[model samples]
Every structure is written in structure tokens, then in C-alpha cells.
Target: MLTNEYLKRVYEGLEKRNANEPEFLQAVREVLESIQPVVEKHPEYEKAGLIERMVEPERIITFRVPWVDDQGKVQVNRGYRVQFNSAIGPYKGGLRFHPSVNQGILKFLGFEQIFKNSLTTLPMGGGKGGSDFDPHGKSDMEVMRFCQSFMTELYRHIGQFVDCPAGDIGVGGREVGYMFGQYKRLTNSFQGGMLTGKGLTFGGSLARTEATGYGLCYFTAEALKCMRNDSFEGKTVVISGSGNVAIYACEKATQLGAKVVTMSDSNGYVYDPNGIDLAYVKDLKEVRRGRIKEYAETHKDATYVADCSKVWTVPCDIALPCATQNEINKESAEALVKGGCTVVCEGANMPSTPEAIEVYLSNGILYGPAKASNAGGVATSGLEMSQNSERLSWSFEEVDAKLKGIMEGIFHASYDASVAAGSEGNLMVGANCAGFLKVAAAMMAQGITY
Candidate 1:
């Protein structure tokens, strides 16, 4: 633990900053709390002012994006790009598009990405950007307009060897296409490697959408093997969210011989006693873009709950929260524990609050944090960048194999770090410290720079 005097000084310095973002503060607090021991052990890092630099971003770009709607009405939205670090390499992260996006959330995500990207053993730094634009219910023209406007400001700050952005929560293939198109028109160059998660025709790799979910399962498989000497075969699993990550997780879990029983979206959840069919889930979420309630309509044995928060009450051996941050609080964690869940893997960023994590740790349940577990998507994106650079693409099977290897390697890295840090089995702290130490070392070697 940090000395009371040291913490007080740190808190005072934090209070004086103009950017007192709550989400960013929360993320920093989590990381700092976990790494206090490391701070004490490594006096050289403290002397080098590593933690101080780690708390702040290198650059933040904010701009207004103006677009025209279908009705000839002009719309405007705020945009942001937080280049959190570049100690390892150029900035590399996702560009989110959602109504809830803001500087605070983006900063927190970017800060986390610094460590997460480092853990992948790839030459990529941390960055994140997004806008307060809601893509849902928007026409293709509106989305295209917004993407073009966004890329106009963004293109100036990004490139193939500099910064590469990919899709996140609200940004999908359509959004990537729009942004890439605008970038091409302005730069007058293809430069396909400047972005990832593109359409297959343009340069996107196969199984990129499935990377995160399949990677989640692969990491969880490693954890299970280490903890219980077992695998996913015949184990019952429950996953939340109907997005790309959730659907892919369901697919991977089913392929690994687990019976996934329930999947949910913001509206509600569908509990299928006969195990969720991956084909039906893909059709509903990907093809139809319908609510999870549609699942219950087709599968008579499944029960649909309109309120998603209540879905945790269903029983399962493993729980995969692939939804938003802080979705599973103490109450939800308790419900999951009561339902016989022995493992909880997060596919979403910070899905479990600190309270919920405490509950899991105290109960001796195996918990996988998002930074360490959900890295497969970005890892595969890095692979896509490699392919683009080489002017070649690997087959789906080859890419999937590489993704599995990376996930497994990350799991073992986190596990070993946890054990060595004397917080054996406490993966959250271990992962944060492992990732932070690497970035901090790189920063120190490079020396201080603006």
C-alpha cells in the first residue's frame, strides 16, 4: 500500500489538473491500487517519474464534425482522439462511435489500451478516439456523412506507420468503409494498412470479427486448465450481449463443446435450455439486426426476459460478460455466484465494477479481466496490419491458430505475473502491473519527451 503522505500528494496533484475526468480517474485508481507494491519495490521507477507520466496522455485532439442529414438538415457532433502513449511504437487502437462516448471514457479506454496493447508482445502503442454520435436508427447516408466528417479531422493525425484505428462498439464494417473512403479521397492513396477491420474486398482479414470471442474462449480455456485441470467440454456457459463479441464468444464456446444457454442484449435476454444455436444467433444479430427477443420467438423452449439486468439470475457453470462496463455490479455478481458460476471472463471493458471483482475474488471464483482476456481482437488487427505490409493475407484457419496462440500466451503471461507478484490467482493486479512495467520501461529507455 502507498504511504498516506504519498497518496495525499498524488491526490493533490491530480486535483489541480484541468482534465479531472471521473472515468479516467477510476481507471487510474484501479491500476495504481494494484501496483502499489510494485511502486514500492521499484524505487527506480518512482525516481524516473514513471507513474506520473503514465497517468497523463501524450496528446488529445478534439474537433467538431459537421454533417448533413437526409432531410437537408445539418447535424454536428464532437470528436476526440486520445494518443495515450507511443513508447513501444505508433499509436494503435479502436475508434468507438456511440451516444455515450466522451473524452473521459475515451481517456480511460486509451489509458487501459497502453497496457493491454503492450501485453500482446506487438509493436503498438496505446490510443483511442470516438464521437458522441449515435449510429443506431441512422440511415446509411447519415452514417456515411458522419464518418466522412470524422475522418476529415482524423486523417491528418493517422497513417500506416504512425497511428492505426479499428472498429469498436458502434463502429462496424459500414463505418470503416465510410471512413476509409473519405481518407482515400483526401489523401489520394489506397494506404490500406492505415486502418484495420475493413471489408474483405479492401483488405480486412478473415475471422477478424471472431477473434475477440474466440480469443476469450482460448484464454478461458487456459485459465480453466491451470486452475482446475479441465477444459470447456460439456460445461454450461452463459454469455451476455448480442454484439460482435458476444455472438463470437457463443460460437467459440459452442465449438469448444460447451453448452451456451443464454445470450442477452440491452433490451433483454433469451434463455435456451437446449443450448443456444450459433447459426440462429448469427442470423438474429448479424443478418437481421433484431433484438434478442426474436430468439425466444423462434425457439419455443427459450425464455425471454425484457429486462436485461435480471438475466444473471439464470444458472450456469461459467459466465461471460461481453457487455458494457460496470454492467455487473455487486448484486449481479452475487446472483451469478448463487447460480453456481465458477468462472467469469470479461469480454467487455471493465464489465465488473471493483465491488463485483472483490466479490469474485473473495468467493474464490476464477475471474478474467477485459484487458487481458479481450485482447484477441486487437492482436488480430495487428496481424492484419502485418498482412497488409506484406501484401498477403493468411487463411482463416491460420489466422485463427495464431489468435489462439496469442490468447494462450497472454493467459500464461498474466498467470505467471500474478504468481510472481505474490498475488497468486489475482489476475487483475498481475495483468496491470505486467503491462505497466513494460510500457514504463520502454518510456524510461526512450527518456522524457513532450
Candidate 2:
């Protein structure tokens, strides 16, 4: 490790700036810890003070989103936009619309996006924005009202050449459409590239919906082939969450001849020992927008566990967490290990806590971090940006092929970084260093700016 002195200085500065922001602190610490070797190897980056500026976002905007509820009652919520970096190109990331959205989470997400986007080799920086309002169980009109109010302020900070936001948890096609409509109305311009993950009718890219999940499976398959001497064929996989990432991951896994045994939601998990069929899971989630427990009711052999935390207990060769942040803790990690999980991949941002990560790493499980594994979404988003710029949309096969190439490239990059760092197969360090060095070099080339 490099001098603790430099790490201490950078960490202390971040702590002082974000005194009570645990998410920001956690995100920064993880990236910094992984990139410490890089700092030691590259004195010029240190001379450039790259670490100091990397954590400080270039722009942050907070505003009130006032809308009307279904009952015609006025509702108010806080919204935030954190433009973390722009050294590469325009700011790019997702707009999460969950109740848990906050400045700390957005900052953490945006900061992570910088490296994730960089790892994609795409011309995009990083930014994340969202509101704390929950979109679930809300009527379409209610969501539209909230989206309009949120975009009223957000549109000012975003543009095709500026920051671009896509959909995250709770911000699906419906939310993106509403947000895009509002942006167009406010700006009086048909700025198609201003946001990604748009519906197909309004210039959304083909395969954008399945990019992250499909990309994750692609990366995991590549890792299995290269590192584990294993294949997805005839393997039992357990996946958490039924959202975009989880659902598509399940689909691709099934297509690869893997039987997905278990899938979960925020409520609980459903384990079908006879391998989960993708069509069933998709209908439950995409069509009905219902919970996983519903699957247990219909499938004879499937068992539903109401306690969501126990989802990790199901035995499988592979485990993928596609849920929210910090969903997997040390206990869940132990459960996964005990259940004989050989590989684990993240489909969500920081789904596994530090302790959980330690357990997996110590056990020598092939683990893929969210930034590297789940980068397919943003990579395709970048493709969408290019298509918008060219006013041409690629076919699904073309986009999927490109996405596969990107994921493969990312895995090789991370693997090379690991080998270069003498960490061998430590993908965490590989991903962090690979991403950081790219962005840090870009920042260095930009020179110092106050």
C-alpha cells in the first residue's frame, strides 16, 4: 500500500466535506482503497492532486418538487442533481426515483458512475439525480405530476451537451417518458439525447432495457470461462430482485442453459428447486408488476420465504444480487458461502456491504462488482447517445452484440489491471484501478481548475 499519509489526507478532506454522509464516505473509501496501488505507481496523478478533485462534484443542485397526490392533496419532496465529473465528456448516469433517494446516495452513485462510464471506454462523464418520492403504487397521473415538477428544476441543469440522466430503480419507461415530456415542454426543443432509457417510441435504444442484465450475464459468463473453469450450462443460479437487472439476468442465464433456482424481491424470495422459467418471472414482474411471492403460490415445488433476508440461504452455483444498496450483509455472505456459491455478481450499486465483500473475497469466490458487472446499462446508454447524435437507431442484434463486446472488454481490462497490480485475480482492485486511472488521467490532462 502507498503511504497512509496520502490516503489519510484525501480521506480526511472527504470526511470534512461530507461530514455525515455515510454513503459518500463508503463509496469514496472503497474506490480509494482499491486504487491505492495505482497512486503509488503513478506519482504524476498524485502531483496532479487527482484524488482531491475526484470526490468533489463539479455541480450539485437541490430543489423542492411539489406535486399533487391522487387525492388532490399537495405533496412535496426533495430532489437532487449531482454532476460529479465531466473530464471525459457530458455527465451521464441514472435518475433513481425511490423513496431512499438522497444527496449522499446520489453523490455516491454519481462518483461511482464516473469510473463505470470510464471503464466502458465511452465518451461520457458521470452524474446522478433523483427525488425521494416513491413511484410505486402511484397512479400514472400522480407520477406525471411529480415528474413534471421534478423536471421543472432538473431540466435547467441538464442537456444533450451537458448532463444526461437515465432510469434507475423506480424510474422506468413511464417515469422517463414523463420526465422527457416535461424537459421538452420546458426547453421547447426535442432533445432526444438529453436522457437515456427512454421508451422505444421516443428514440430509446433497442436492448437498452436489457443491457445491464444481459451485460452482467455476459461478464459473468466470461469470468466463469476464464477464471473458474466453469460454464453456465446445467448450473443452478440464485438471483435477487425482479427488477430490470435481475429479470434480464435470469432470462439470459436461462438461455445460457442455467437453471435459475431462486429469485427475490424487496418483500421476499421464491425458490423453485426445479429451475425458474424466465417467462414466468417476466410475467410476474414486467406484466403484473407483482412480487416474487406470487410465483410460489402457483408453482407446486416453489417455496416462498416472507423474510427477504433469507434469500441468500438458497443453494446455488452462482448468486446475483440485483436489488438495492447494502442488501447483502455479512450474514448473507456467510449464507451464500455455506450454500456453496462459487461465483457472485452484483447487479445493483454496492449491493454487498464491506463485510459481505470481505467474506466473499476471503473465501476466494469469483466476485464481480456492480460498477464493472452492471455497466451494460450505461454502456448501452452511451450507444443510445451516439445513435441520437446520428439520428439512427441500431437493431437489437447490433446493440446486443456491441454490449457483449463492451462487457468482454471491461472484464479483460479489469483482469489486466489485477495482473498488473500483482493482485492476480482481485477484480475489485482491478475494476477500481482501471476505472480510476482512466478518469484520473483525463482529469490530469484537463489541468487544475478551481
Candidate 3:
């Protein structure tokens, strides 16, 4: 229930227009509900129709992506790029390549990026693009062809100083390399700033690969220290996902004196009470591209469960949902609360459902929202963009130090915003308000645009 009249009207309008877009609606409602305080404080925003304009994207590009497989079979996939807002800076976000890619999901992600970028204290706006073409089980050649086709139309809408797309979900370094190569060939120039998450030999920044996961831990450590006078030391952490974020999160958690007991993929989750072996998980998931079940098979002490959601059932001090959107539902939230989980930080965008978040908040858990906690990846991406613009690369330690400082700053901002809003320790509200205030101020300063 949005208390502000203008905010409620804007949300109702969004619902009418995006009736079928539950994800986008959820994202919109969450932010709108959180920002009622700001709306009440600044009635000028309503008179200027800022909420209406901000909820709607500036441009939505949809096109048919036709590519051929290794067997010469032509396949068609739908691609989309939603340039949500650029009031603060250029449109910057990741290009996902999952089968679930749709206008609704992209819009939700783009909307979230607006604030996520704002939280980074960087001059980057919100945009997200992706195709429904799944890269899993595809041959290298097939993936390359798809990337080429996807970039063919996308190149016209993006540039170094304009929209910059990086990797998300199924899109990784291999896919980024393919897309970067296509963009370079299409434009006939080496504009490295056009993409992040590229190979080190290309324009990718140091610590970019580990930024999100490592940053999750850093943010969590700050929250723990501030709220509970504690840290990750001796905490039993359970992380969801076997991808880059989870793997590196596990590595960083281990380094920070925490034991990561579980890591999961879509198919299932593996549990090792003695703390997961980061080396083997990385080798299996990153290098071999194998499923997480292999970890249980190789290590007799571990057990593999077919249901990935059950990973939350294990008792732990902290939980990091690093997998995907809405992964932690109400039932999972209940499980975490019942199991004595004190903190839940999102390493993936909108990983917890509204119900799940409500449960966590009511239970007095220190919840770190994705926009602030997961901003590390894009923060480092911003760093990559700076490096590319200067044609200079910083060392791993340099980038890592910067990433750490940014994550800490995000925590404090969210914390202070929460306190100022009278919500005390509610990070979701704090993050939404903090992130939105920055972009909203910039929008107001720039004046109205028809």
C-alpha cells in the first residue's frame, strides 16, 4: 500500500500498462512503497511527474535475433534493450543470455540498475538488454554466431559513451569476447569502453571477475560489524549458485574467516559440512563447466540435493542468495528464520520475493538488498570503463581496494538513509531511498524533458 497519493497513482498507471509484467511491477511497487517518505517530503516531484517518467523507460528496443547452429539450423530468438533512465549518466547494465529473457525481466533489471548505479556514486544510468537464447549446451561456434547476430542490431543503439552492455547470467567472458569482437568488427575500431567483463588481454579490469562475490562479503561484513558488532569470522555461510558470483563469494568468505557450507546450481545444491572446497568448485563449474552434482560425487563427505531451493534449509549464520531473481520465496524465508540465520544479503538482482523480504525484516534479520550489495560488479565495471577510456589498467590490489571502499560506502549510505527515514535498520528501505534520492535529485536538477 503506497501512502502517497501521487506514488499510488503512478503505480496504478504502471500496473494498467504492464499488466502482464509481474517482475517489473514488483520491482516498481517495492521502490515506490519505500520512497513515500521522500514523496511526502518533496511534493514538487509529483507536480513534475517525476515518478511517472521514471517508471517508464526512455526507449525499448525489441528485435528478432536470427542465428544458425553448428548443424546449419536457423534459430530465432527475441532480444530486448530497455534504456530506462540516463539522467545521471550513460545507460549502463549487463546483457543476459538466458531462456527467460523477456521485456518484463529486462525492464525490472533496468529499473533496478538506475539506483544500483546511483549507489555506486558513479556517473552511470540504468539499461538492460538480453536475448532468450540460452548459451548452455551450445557449441562455441553456435554461441559465437548468436553473439554476432545479437550485436548486429544492438551496435546501432550502443556506444562507448552511450549504452554499455556487459555480461549477466548465461553471458560470461566467452560470450562477452564474442560480442566485443563483433562490435569491433562492425564499427571497424577498438573501442574498449563499449563493454566490460572482457578477457584481461582485452579491456577487462583487474578484480572485475571477483568484484560481485567479494563485494557481497565486504558489504555483509560491514553490516554485521555495524549492527551486531560482529563480522564474518566463524560464521557458517550458505551461498546459492555455482557461477562466478557464488564461487568468488565462497572464496572471499573463506578468506574472511567464514566457512561456506553449500553452493548450488539450477539443477541442485551440494552441501559439505566441512566447508566447500573453493578450488574444486571453481575447477568443476568454471573450467570444466560441469554441474554441481559432480562435487558430491568426487567428495564422499558431501551430499547433493536435487532441489536447489532446499539449500536454504541447512542451518547457517548467514545466507547469500547469489543465484537469480525470486529464488528465496516465503517458504525459504521461513526456513532461514527458523534455522537461526541472522543475515541475508542478495548477490543477485531481486533474489528475494517481497514476501521473503517481509519475513526477513519482521524477523529482525539484517537484510542487504541487491542494489547496494551487488553494486560491486557494476562498480568495477565502471572502473573498467574508466580504465578503457584512459587506455590504462590497474593492478588487482588497486581495483580490489577501490571495490572494498565502494562497498563500505554503500553500506554506510544505506544505513544512514534507513536511520534518517526512521526505519532504523531496514536496509531494503534505506537502499531504495538512498539510491532513488540520488537519481531523483539529478532528474529534478535537469528539469522536465518532453
The whole-model lDDT of each prediction reads 0.88, 0.91, 0.94
Q: What is the TM-score of each candidate against the true structure?
A: 0.97, 0.98, 0.99
For residues 320-408, write the lDDT of model 3, one tens digit per residue.
Answer: 99999999999999999999899999999999999999999889899999999999999999999999999999999999999999999
Which residue runs of candidate 2 sit more than 4 Å off their true CA positions?
1-3
List candidate 1 segments past 4 Å from native.
1-8, 15-20
- Please list all clashing residue pairs in model 2, or write none if there are none: none
Give the poorly placed runs of model 3, Cα more than 4 Å off: none
Residue 107 displacement (Å), model 2: 1.0
Rank by TM-score, highest first. Answer: 3, 2, 1
Q: Candidate 1: global Cα-lDDT?
A: 0.88
Model 2 Cα RMSD, 1 decimal = 1.3
Task: Please report the TM-score between candidate 1 and the true structure.
Answer: 0.97
What would the per-residue lDDT of candidate 2 be over residues 287-358, giving only the tens digit for each residue? 788888889889999999997789999888899899888999999999999999989999999999999999
lDDT preference between candidates 2 and 3, better one = 3
Specify the highest-lDDT model's number: 3
